[model samples]
Structures are given as structure tokens and as C-alpha cells.
Target: MKRVQAALQHFAQAVAAAMMAAMFLTFMLQIVVRYSARLEWLADRFPILNPSLYGWTLEFCLLLWIWLVFWGNAFVVRDRDHVTFDILFVTVRPAVRRWFIIISGISICTALVVSIEPTWAKFYILRLKKTATLSTIFGDWIRMRDIYSIYIFFLVAVALRYAWAVYRAVRFGVEEPVEAPAGQPTK
Candidate 1:
């Protein structure tokens, strides 16, 4: 299970990276085209007529941004690196801290599970709508639900991560995170 989770995390990270890169490229292309369009001489010389790839840039950047955010959340959860108001928790005894982790993790997992159905329904309804840029250009339009499905994946990954956290906290109690050397893996 750990291996599979790690593999999925890696895959999600790679996809998020690719999406970010593509978003950058498309945004740059929009900038170049917008500037080029300003110069009538250049516009005339170029084979392109409408130098407004703005729609495409906006659509894809937003699409990629949404995906990257949800996928990134899983990474944050995996590392237990989410925001902490540890002013109190940090001062507690080790036994108290373990209980805190377990309790919080269970709550998070429960919340995620409860959200799954409503989230799915909302995204499913989104499927009825087509993307303006991607669908229009591809001719074989993609549904909004397809783009929004990343949230579903995020919810599952996070729920699993938190569930694992709860299990570990229950089985081993509150333990400090192992701090490995810069280049070494934590045991």
C-alpha cells in the first residue's frame, strides 16, 4: 500500500509539473502573440491573422492551475506539512500530541468521505458543459467534469493519507517526525 501510494504521488507530481510547464508555455505564447499583433507590419507579415491566443492561454492555465492545486494538496497531506497552529500542540506532552494527531486525522478523513458524494454530483453535472477552448479546438470537446475530476482524486488521496495517519497514531502513539540528513531518507 505504501509503495502504491508513493508511486501515485510521484505520478501526480509529474503530471502537475507537466501541466505547470504547459501553462507557462501557453501563457508566454499569448504574450508574444499579443505583442506581435500590436505591430501592424508584423501582423501583416505573419501567417497568423488573429494573434489572440488569449482564450486558449486563459483556459489552459486555469485548467492546469486547478489540477496542480488539488494534486499538490496530496503531497502536502503525505508530508503532514499542512498549516499548523502548533502554539498549543507543540507545548503538549508526547502522549497528548499523539492523541491530537489521531483525533485530527480521523476528523479530516471523515470530512473528506462525507464530501465525496456531493463533490461527485457537482462534477458530474459539470460534465454536461463543454470547455470553450479545449473542446472548441479539439472538435471532440472535453467535458467540464473531466477537468474537475482532479478534486475527486485529491479527496481520495488525502483521505487515505489521513486514514493512514490515524492508523499510525493509534498503533504507535504520538511520535516525533524523524529528521533525516539532507540527502538521507527518514526511517
Candidate 2:
């Protein structure tokens, strides 16, 4: 069981890293292409190849970035690296803190479940509509665009992670170790 969990964690990390790299590279490529064209004065030389095309590239790149970031968020939560109000927890008694953590985990899991269906529906609609670049006739679904794929992946991952967190909270009662502040007393 431990090995399986470790493997899953590693796989999630790899997926997140790959997505982030792809998003970064896509944006960088778009920037380089746009700047190169501008430097070469090709926009003036070729009326058809205008700077407006860069706007399309920017939109595509932004969408990719959103997908990558959201997809990676699940792994962030799994690792317990997501943002939190630690100071409040620290002030509470350990037993109370444990209950609070468990309750919060369950609430988040419930929320994720409720939200997933609608979110997936939205993605399905977009996919069915074949949304795509204005210049291209191929819709996102037909082209298998990253936006649709990544959104689906993100929703699934978030649901799974939150579900696991809820399971852990129930089974273990949320006695997970809290990291100490740097230079603080361990006890």
C-alpha cells in the first residue's frame, strides 16, 4: 500500500512538471516568434502576417498556463504544501486541532465532489462545441487541444486527492505531523 501511494505521488509530480514545462515552452516560443517577426519588420513587409496573430498565441499560452497550474494543484495538496493558516492551528490544542483538520478535510472533499460534476459538464460542452482558434476551423475537441484535456485531468486529480485526504483523516484522525518553524523549540 505504501509503495502504491509513493508511486502515485511520483507519477503526479512528473505529470505536473511536464505540464508546467510545456506551458512555459509554449509561452516562450510564442514570445520569441512574435519578437523575431517584429524585429525583422515582417509585419510591414507581409500584411497578412500581422501582430494580431500574436494575440491569438498569447491567448493560447495563457490557457495552457492555467491548465498546467490547476493540474499541478492536486499534487500540491497531496504533499500538504497548499497554503494554510498555520498560526491559528498552532494556537489550538492538539486534540482540537486534529478535529478541525479532519472536519476541514471532509468539507473540502465534499465541496470538490459537488463542484466536479458541473465543472466536467462545462468542459464537455466546450469540447462538444469544438471551440478553437478563430483562424482555424478545427474545434478544440477535434484537435484534442490541451485546454480540454488538462481541465479534465485537473478536475479528476483534485477530486481524487481530496477524497484521499478525507479517507486519511477518517482512518488516522488527522494526527499528521506539523512542521516546526525554523529555529523554534521542537516540543
Candidate 3:
């Protein structure tokens, strides 16, 4: 099970890395194409020097960025990597902290689960809307629904993560989060 989970984690990280690489390359291509249209030498040589020819790059970058943020948060980022104002949580003892974790987890999980249907409904409506530039490349087949679909995955993944956390807290309880002194950094 541990091995399987580790492999999954590596795969998720790889996916995120690939998304970032693609976004970076697309952005660079946009820049090169934009500037090439301005340079007389290059413009004279390349008939396809119109920056507008690659207008889809902007939309593609935005799409990848949305996916990267949600997907990375859902699978790649660990719980501890999240920023939290945990003054109340950290002040409490281990037993109280366990209850806090359980309660918070349940609340978050419930909220996300409840939102799934409404989110799906919104996405369904979005299917009618095609992107301005991307449609030129991918044809009318690509809609706003396809670009934003990663959000649903993010919602489900986070809800499941919280559900798992709640289960673990119930089974073995939670320990206090490690903290450094007032001035020292956490290791």
C-alpha cells in the first residue's frame, strides 16, 4: 500500500512538473513570436511572423495555470504545507486537538461533498461556451467545461483527503503540531 501510494505521489508530481514545463514553453513561444513580428529581419524571412498566429498560447497558458494550481494543491502539496492560523488549535492539548481535527475535517468534507452537484451543474452550463482563441486551434469541440474540469477533481480529492484524516484521527487520535520557539524557525 505504501509503495503504491509513493508511486502515485511521484506520478502526481510528474504531472505537475510537466504542466509547468509546458506552460513555460508556451509562454516563451508567445514571447518569441510576438518579438519576431517586430524584428524586420525575422519578419522579412518568415511569412508567418504574425504574433496573432499564436494567440492561443495565452489561453493555453491560463488553462495550464488553473490546472496546475488545483491539481498541485489536491495531490502534490501536503497538509502541513498549507498556511494556517492555528493559534487556537496549537494552544489546546492532544485530546482536544484530536477532536478539533475530527470536527474540522468532517465540516470541510461535508461542505465539499455538498458542493459537487452545484459545481457540476455550473460546468454543464459552461459546455455551451467556447474559448475565444483556443477554439480556433481545437475547433468547436473544446468548451469551457473541458478546461475547468480539473476543479471537480480537486474538490473530490480534497474531500477524500479530509475524510481520511478524520478516520485516522478517530482511530489513533492526533498529536500536537511541532512548533519552534518564538524566534527560531521550524526544522
Which candidate comes out best when scored by lDDT? 3
What lDDT score belongs to each candidate, Candidate 1 first?
A: 0.80, 0.64, 0.91
Whose TM-score is greatest here?
Answer: 3
Candidate 1 residue-wise lDDT at 105: 96
Lowest-sum lDDT 10-residue window in model 3: 43-52
- Write candidate 3's Cα lDDT for 63-135 as tens digits: 9999999999999999877888889988889899999989999999999999999999989989999999998
Task: Return the lDDT, model 2, position 27.
Answer: 77
Q: CA shift at 82, candidate 3, in angstroms?
A: 0.8
TM-score of 1: 0.83
lDDT of 1 by residue, 78-145 (tens): 46455556678767888998989888999999999999999998787897898887755656558888
Runs in model 3 deviating more than 4 A are: 180-187
Per-candidate total of colliding backbone pairs: 0, 0, 0
Candidate 3 C-alpha RMSD relative to the actual structure: 2.0
C-alpha lDDT of candidate 1 relative to the true structure: 0.80
Better candidate by TM-score, 2 or 3: 3
Listing every candidate in turn, what is its Cα RMSD in Å to the true structure after a full C-alpha superposition? 3.5, 4.5, 2.0
